[model samples]
Target chain A: MHNEKVDILLIEGNDYEAKLALHNLKKHNLTNNLLHLRDGEQAADYIFATGEYEGRDISNRPKVVLLDINLPKMNGMEILKKIKSDERTRTIPVVILTSSRENRDVAEGYALGANSYIVKPIEFGSFSETITSLGLYWAIMNQEAPYIPNNLWQSISEA
Target chain B: MKNILLMKFFSTAAVTPKRFHFSAQKSEFEISHIPFKDSGVSVVNSSGQLLVAKQEIDTIETKPVMRTLHNARKIAEDAIIKNCPDVICALDRKGRFLTINDACVLWGYSPEEIEGKFFTDFVVADDIEKTLKAACACISTGKRTSIDNRCAHKEGHSIPMLWSVSWSADDNLFYCSGRDASDIKSAEISLQESTQRYRSLFDYNPDAVYSLDLKGNFTSANAKVAELTGCPIDQILTMSFVPFVDPEYMSVAAESFRKAAAGEKISYDLVIIDISGNRRHLNISNMPMIVHGKFTGIYGVAKDISESEANKAELKKLNESLEMKIMERTSQLEQSIKEMEAFSYSVSHDLRAPLRIINGYTKLLSNEYEGKFDADGKEFMTAIIENTKYMSRLIDDLLNLSRLGREAINKTIVDMNLITQVVIHELKMEDNSIVADFKIQDLSPTVCDQRLIRQVWTNLISNAIKYSKKKGTPQIEIGSYEKGNQTVYYIKDNGAGFDMKFAAKLFGVFVRLHDRSEFDGTGVGLALVQRIISKHGGKVWANGKVDEGAVFYFSLPNS
Candidate 1:
């Protein structure tokens, strides 16, 4: 039931922009079963189903992960690295979308195995189009890995 | 007219031998032959009366006939003497006067009164020797000759006269006719006046006009031409005209002269030496003057051409500078195009990505974890959202700087202090947190793009407020003064100041002298200020030391 509840994970910081984007995504019908993580460390620990997310099912990896760059604690780049480095979540798709098209973020995103990098458009119409396309692509078209039983997946992870 | 003829005949008779033919009437003795010379005789009657005398019937030589002839001649001569306009006088063999016409009598004494006076006494002292010599020659040769002499007028001044003399063989008398030549003297005076008028025109004409022979000798020149050429007229007459020309222009001068002498009108420029030995440029036109189909000399007129040549040189330099300025403007336009491209890339790359992250994950948060997170967790997420929105604002300021750099200055009259006050008032309306002490001084008007100048004031005033936000009471002073011909304005702020060592990078885009944490700006405001001021033919500078308040100064063109 716990694994079924967390269908997707989203990490973001800037509260106003985060709220605006959240409103936009809710209209797209993609984030109905999604979970929100505020900082890099929380996002990393929860994905591995350790720390705050311990005792929860780790076998059910989310369909996708959305990340924002400006954060209160550990930033988006480190969160992306933690997910790609682990065997259990390495196959999970991570999409980085931010207000800053800062060179460091784009380069680090690619280096850390980010699946997609998108810059938020300023105009409302273009932002809507960008979110709708991202949702359709990752949720409907992309082929997610089948759920591995906890015994097999965790035993392989322990080894 | 008849009196003039009789006087002419009597004067001729006094000089010529007396000869007459007369006829006798009932009581009048008429000499048929009276030898005007002594070789003939006249006849008389038995009553001792005069009668016609003749050596033969055709020629007369009788004493009565000679007396009758002499009486008749005297009567005719008296009529001529009374009517002649010119003075007429006779001189004896000894150069003494024998008779005079009425004109001569009127001119001086009567014929009887001066009959024996020597002719030299009537002549002026200077003319006496010449008169005596002419008289002696006339008496000896008995030749009809004329001489000009100054004779004493009745008023005691000398009157010029021409006298003609001949010998009379009959009475052995020397006969003379003297005519006053005062009319000739008046003609001479008129001739002198015309010569002086011609000379004055030549001497005072502005253009130097002179005549030169084919040999390059200056044959004639006006007084001014002589002075301009630095040669006396007498000296120039013998010297070569080529000597006054600069050595470099001598060949050209010679060729021009040769062409002119060959009947070709030649015009050219020459550098010549003036009276003070200073070189002068003259435009000279030379042409050959011919009289009666014979080439006399070359006539030339010269005017100064130095100023015109200098003006041409100045115009050439100005054209060169204009071309250089056009080239510089074209290159600047090209550079701005490239910078605009870079700015577009910055918009797409640096600005949009943060906005995307903020929008995307913030959406994920509220949607996925709305009821799950605590209030503090939600608050932290909201702060991230606020900061990213501000980041977009910073990017816009950067784009504004790029745009400001590219636009051309649309110049108009602007009052800088007025603009500063408006910006200050706007800022005050937005944030009333800090007390701002504005010491605004009077500002002069200058020609500038008012809209661009508004941006300048907005940037500087906003920056002052932003930098001084933390201070308990912000004191900002806006003032302007004239330096040389330009109006310089400054915004002084009581705030955290920056080091002056980084002044070199003050106007560079996004170059912040202060830390972003210290001042809430993208560092594009001052750069925009500088760009707008620089476009107005002005410059901007910042003066600040650490911990001291900073002052930003900019200047605008006076006109």
Candidate 2:
């Protein structure tokens, strides 16, 4: 299941929020190659091919990573910092999708190289609309960066 | 001329007389014979005492002529001794008065009555020894000696006398003269009393009174100077003022002293260390001591002000510490505000998530399983969704209210008429069923935070519409008028007015006057309106009656 081409990675800690996001993405037909991680730690492991995903191909990165700010382990901000700092996955667009509309979190998310910061609304219609637009935009409309091999990246950095 | 002719005839005739007799009544002369030279003639009185023997007589009647010349000389001498103003007296060797002149009346004594009395009897008891000593010295040295003593008067008062006595060895008597010295004595006494008064004034003064010589050495100092310098008066006088002055204020002290010595009165403040090493702040005044039209020294009066100086320093320190404490408290308040904002943000996010999920699933349940649900179940589901939305609005209003506290007001001149019109237009658009006729008048422009003031108008206008919409023809009037330094705006409505008693509770958070079933409200609108107006330094109040009408008024300062 982990070997497949992951188009979108949803890293949400809450079960209900994750289910709702998945449902909305499925309704929009953007869940075909989507992978949902329950916590920041699992998402980090999958993204960097560490821990349980050590043997996995690190070159096969997701197109977009949807991050929630509040998480159980290795919270969303820490995960965002790790992903943006690593050369292997820095190019992947990390969109912050959280329930918090706090200015501090929004500013920090963008400062840490998040592609987009969106607040999840409470109403069903508005929430459904936001998740659907977010999924369609990141998965279908947004252009993904071209993948470069590790040797090429190393050479480029040295040069 | 007749006597000269007679004298020439007698000389030529060689006439002499051993005894002469002349009677003015008889006009005859009898002369007795005596030895006589051919070229000289002698005239004698009837007692045969020779009156003149060197000159030739003109006739044997020369006795009367001789007696007349002697009487004239004796009269002049007696006049002089009788009229002398001083007590000119002759005293015997035993200090007895042999004779005294009429000037003895100055001592209340007659010359005849005091003739035989001892001179010492008239001397004051206190001066007797001095008078005796002076007389003895005069007798021994035969020199004139002067003494000042009091003579006892017959009236019992002592008369101050200045006596000059001389011993005459030929008569073995003391010739003494005494003058009245009352005036001199009174002058000396007054001078002594004035000096005493000045000395007391100097010593008893509270301030340190001292005099410094031209070289800045202490010449004289009062007792207070001893106390202030923590040194004895004698020691202070032995030292100059330079050693007692604090080094920091030595130059100032020197300058003031120099100016004073130059005859300029100078006053200055300086610090001094006393003998005990205690620092004393002093305000000193220095003036030139002009004695007998000459600048003699510097007179100084110093007042200790150490206590007041210390208090001033303490007050300055307290002011600095108070300012520091205020800054500390202000930062603490800012920190708490930041923390509260964080908490509100967390509440906004965390509290709404479950509600969102509940509402989302409920809507999905209603839409997907519409056939299985009965009418009541559907209504219950609808209520859940409605209540969730209401709770969400309540949370949003609460956040907005809390956020108002920390929001920095950006103020500008806002037109009240325009904001009211916009709010009215927006309210009409939101609910077209609001057929309440609006009577908006020309409003004065005021300085306020534009965004917050707009929110105020929105809340007030919507409240008016909501409360008055049930009337047949709801009449709403909005107008503003100038009140003192403020522009007061009012919104009146014909609606379900609350009791006037609960008017004070209207702006309280979550304090609803009407039941929820009658008027649908979360009870936070008026509170938000109040908060916004208050933050702008404005006031919000309402006047209402039961079922008649309610009018809300707000005043903004016209700056």
Candidate 3:
């Protein structure tokens, strides 16, 4: 039930892109399971439970993070590095949805541990369709990383 | 009579007919004659040798001896009077010809006419004083002296003659021999004229003409050389060429003069210092001076070329600056092109964001308010959505065109058959409700940018299917053939083809041959195809007939 609650995290630089991406994901019936973070810094904070997201349950990791490269405080490559470096959220998938097909950001994003790189098309129809399929792929079809609750994690360590 | 007889006795005694050996006394003629041959008059025997003056000699020889002396005098006068090569004449103290030889006829005068004529009258007036001086000298010295004077002919022309005159004191007469000298005089005159012409040429020539003696010392230099040095000719002649030549070329001038003095002709370029101390370039040609097969000196001519040399240097400098200017302009153009590429990327990303939102909101409006809007409002929203979609496609096509200029080609071996099949399958899948009968032919492989070539296939196959879908069971044929050095791939479709006359407008970015009601699309497909094909160094063309079918072909390099 805890894994079912915190489903996907959307880190989008543009508000419109985030709205469309969420709209597409909600169309796939993943509305209650999705969380929209504004920028890479806020996304990192939400994942690590720091800054504005302090004292939050850190173990309730989302199934996937849809990251956009062009962000305000911390760009996607930096945030991807932070999440992939941490063992707690390292196994969670982070897919890049960006407006830029510029090879520099794409190559850097993958090297910094992005799972998939997708270009946000300007046509709303195709844009929403790509996000919908990616959402279904990550939330429904994809297997989640094993989560060990606090009690179970402590006991497994003792054994 | 006794003197006449004595004359005949002397003649007989001086020229005896027989060999008579006589020894005469030193004082006079106390002589003894021993004649062994027969003698007309008998001489005495050796003991008594005296023979009295012959009383018979007076009777026998007076008339004959007198006649013989007269005949000998006439012979000597005749010998002096006749002349062939020389005109013989006798002149008095006043230089009058008393007796003239027959050779006077050579001057159109007879001996009788010239006799008793004043010899000075036949002499040219210009030579009269000289002739008179020679006559006086002849009388005083009584020796042969020569005079070259012109003599007047009877025809009013003068001929040069060389006269040899001598005085005979005994006869109180001067004898003269006159010889023609016309040829020698004319030869001397021509030689003087030739020397004058050569001197005029040297003085008037614009170039500096100078001559050096065998020691490389200046003998004579023309006025031009003086003008160059700003010195008079006499002063230039006194000065050697060394002072006028620049110090850098002083040794070279010396070497060249040495060569010329050795009877070798040489020429060289040198720099000289002018009166103002400015350096001037000069070309000097030196040749050995030979006179009558004897080495005389070296003659040379110099020409100033300083202005022309300066022009050559200026032209070279201009050419170098021109090359630099061209390079600068080329770099400026390249900078503008790079800035334009960045601007194209900005247009692609930033401009499309709003268009996407416009399109996304319209979709939401239609979905949320399914029946809230009337049919007119709904249709208007659809139009907005369609127009937004077209604008997005225009941005993409424009980006592709500008990107072709910016990005380098990433070439690979592209298989046309597989690419055509993939394009066809993708085109049908994008609109799966449509049916297409694709006739694909054998296609060869090519080396090109795989992504751009795939774009080419995508635009072309989609165009074919979109246009031909109006027909029942739309038929499309994809084939390739070989042309000169290239392979041409064609897509033929049974479609609503365009008029051939408007084919030129088909590839324009915003041009649409068909109405929006008949076909729903932007006109960027063919333009994108053209851009991609040309980026691969190829060409594209389309042929279509109204109500018939259409075929689009594109070419690429075989390798």
Going through the candidates in order, their DockQ values are: 0.11, 0.49, 0.33
Residues B236-314, candidate 1: write the lDDT tens digits.
7788777788998999988888889899998999999866888878899998889799999888888777688788899
Per-residue lDDT of B518-540 in model 3, one digit per residue for the tens? Answer: 88777777887887788888999
Model 2: runs farther than 4 Å from truth?
A85-88, A148-159, B1-206, B220-223, B230-235, B243-279, B283-301, B309-335
For model 2, residues A1-159, the per-residue Cα lDDT tens digits are: 368889999998888878877888888788999988888788899998888888888878888899888887789999999989887789999999887776779899999999899888888889889989888888889899987777898999899
- For candidate 3, the clash count comes to 0
User: Candidate 2's residue-wise lDDT over B1-559, tens digit each?
Assistant: 3233333333444443444344332333333444245424344445566644544554445666556534433543555566667778889999899988889999888888899999778998888898888888888888999989998899999999988889999988888888898988899999999999988889998889999999999999999899988999989989999999999998998888889999999889999999999999999999999999999999999998889999999999999999999999999998998899888988888888888889899988898899999999999999999989888888888888888887899999888888988888888898888798989999888899989989988888888888887899889999999889889999999998889889889999999988877888888989999988888788999998887889999998878
Model 1: how far residue B233 lies from native, Å:
26
Judge the docking of candidate 2 as incorrect, acceptable, medium or high: acceptable
Instruction: Give every candidate's TM-score on chain A.
Output: 0.84, 0.94, 0.86
The whole-model C-alpha lDDT of candidate 3 against the native structure comes to 0.78
Residue pair clashes in candidate 2: none
| Best of the two (2, 3) by lDDT | 2
Clashes of each: 42, 0, 0
Ranking by lDDT: 2, 3, 1
**Candidate 1 chain B: minimum summed lDDT over ten consecutive residues — where?**
B25-34
Here, model 1's chain A TM-score works out at: 0.84
